[model samples]
Target: MENINIKQSDGAASLAKVYAIANQKGGVGKTTTALTLGEALTREGKKVLVIDLDPHANASVHMSYFPETVTTSAHDLFFDDADFKSLWGKIVKKREWVGFDFVPASIRLSELEVDLKDRKNKGMVLSNSLDEVKEYYDYILIDCPPHVGVLLVNAIVAADIVLIPIQTDFLALYGIRLLFDTIKILNKVLPSPVKFRALPTMYDGRAGACRKILNLIRRKLGDKVFSTVIHMDTKFREACASGRIIFDVDPKTRGAQEYMQLAREIVRNENA
Candidate 1:
């Protein structure tokens, strides 16, 4: 991958391409996309780090780190005053099987909205924290919660690109507008507007409604919509349940193939 051209707060160039996988709608494959794409990027020999910002900790559980069991997690980044260099080893857990590192989430993150409500520059907290260690990886993917809150704002502010996974359904379409509006408001104060792409997920070709919605997304969004469409697959659920990536469970499956293609597209796009 080519250099991302983003700079840290200290004026040093950042090595990682930070991607926030976000959507205010639930069951839209936000966590799935984050994990699967992290796995796919590793297949291409990229160093990847996935940060679970969701209080629900679905990604943490899938990666075999429970919210209650993890010694330290992403939650600490928000509340702890220690330098990230000292906390990095403790917060970032490596999964050898998946070939990536991740910052797990805990239930404590659920209370951050209330805890940080009065804090100054709260949205920049994650961004500032990530600047301390972004050079260690080639890509950093954040799995954001399915809601409009301080957590989601922090993720978007910290990201170079916000990858919105949109399920191919009517109600899912409404989520795009909500998130876009949020991004618009954020851009007013951001140094630069956050870049974003819409990814169609859970598509079933047999369902006419799914096909129509996919078409509508592309028609309305144009090139903002990714060329790769993630088809509905039971293997993804199985892999999550088994704590394995799709490539490990069955690389031959369509779900695995699509994510690999998506990774290649990202690599090529960055290189371009």
Candidate 2:
């Protein structure tokens, strides 16, 4: 790992905390964390923008925005040769709830990796696009894909902080080394390298193996690991199935409370 620093630009419209929820390994609750944290932040009176960069568009589906119905999406943001401001206007879809907006992803994005693989400034596309409406958001959260590719690279490049949601399992940690290596390479090209924190998710306190993996992750990452751990709960899947935020489904549940704590922890980490 290399030393990373965050640079605050004066040109930013609002001091939005740009976070990319990324992990090379799938099934680690990346989308779940992104949506939950975004909603939690909104409850705290912060305006949040969630960008679904995954072609699967689970976050969008969870929010009830079907890909077939979405006219302008993240695919347009990346592939359409239009001015970012204009594209931003076209792509951003406001949620029924105030203070939350998102750029849904379409299956077309799966084809984008090959389309822009040869583009000179492909990695910077997302960063430039988000700058157009940065002032309107207090936090910009991107739900990245499960693999390292052009899309993932764009997300990492655009982010101020890369939040890795790791499940409390050995398999989830298997390929994280590759993710760190990718970050190190990308950071070398950035003026201010993006900082990262590994968050342990889907933890089951009763499972000895889960607890062991969490401890092992802490030992390996040390301070790079967040203090807040998201324990596994059935509420996450239930909330997603119901298309409601965990807070709305069951605010008093441990799952909801943990997500709220994670949101606060992120805010404090950013300020620190």
Candidate 3:
């Protein structure tokens, strides 16, 4: 894989570092990491925009925007040829509570595979679309779907970094090889291979199995594994139920603190 290079457009260089939070396996805390990291980045005084590409719309709902009510969403970027000005004005919604911009996901996104099946450059659609507004933010977080398909490809193609949240358990490593293989295949075609980091989530220090899995992850991936580990926290569920981020629910909690550390790590790495 090539050294990390942020995607640059034709005009002035884009300030945004796009991150795709993805994992082929479900229940791996992809949405949680996306939303929390977004909020955490905002707390660090960075402008963040989260693009919800998951058809389940978990990130959208947690941010208090329901897909059913929105007329335009991330789905429109895939199908419509609307100008950046129109799309930005219509699709991006500001969240006052978390202080980040968001593009909600629509249930209609589930149909995009068939809808754009015949299109030649379906994967490049998102990369092209994001370039229009990339200069406006410091970070753009894309919440990808669980399964691999057109939407996942679009997200990967558009991202500078792909964050994979791995649940620390006996089955933690299961099916992850498939995702690695997919990236390898993409690297054959991309100008630069997508950079990725594995974040261990839902960890319980009391559980020997969790510790063993986390150790195995670090042993297997070395520097690719993030130092920050998201411990199992019930507050995450409460925050989701209340339609707020962990920081709003309780900033002092481990869940909130760890995500903040993650944001700092990312920023520090960029500077390095």
Name the candidate that leads on lDDT.
1
Give lDDT tens digits, candidate 3, residues 1-272: 11112323346454699999988888989999999999899899887889899999999888877877878789999877667556666788876677678889999999999999999998999999888788878899999998889999999999999999999976657647778888998999999988999999999999999999999999999999999999999999999999999988899999999999999999998889
Residue pairs in candidate 2 whose N, alpha carbon or C atoms collide under 3 angstroms? 14-135
| Candidate 1 similarity to native, TM-score | 0.93
TM-score of each: 0.93, 0.91, 0.93
RMSD of 1: 4.8
Query: lDDT values of the candidates?
Result: 0.89, 0.84, 0.87
TM-score-wise, the better of 2 and 3 is: 3
- Stretches of candidate 2 off by over 4 Å are 1-13, 97-99
In candidate 1, stretches whose alpha carbon ends up further than 4 angstroms from where it belongs are 1-14
Task: Identify the superior model by lDDT, candidate 2 or candidate 3.
Answer: 3
Per-residue lDDT of candidate 1, residues 1-272 (tens digit) = 11122223344354789999999888999999999999899999887889999999999999888877787889999977567666766788876688777889999999998999899999999998888778777899999988889999999999999999999999998888899999999999999998999999999999999999999999999998899999999999899889999898899999999999999999999999
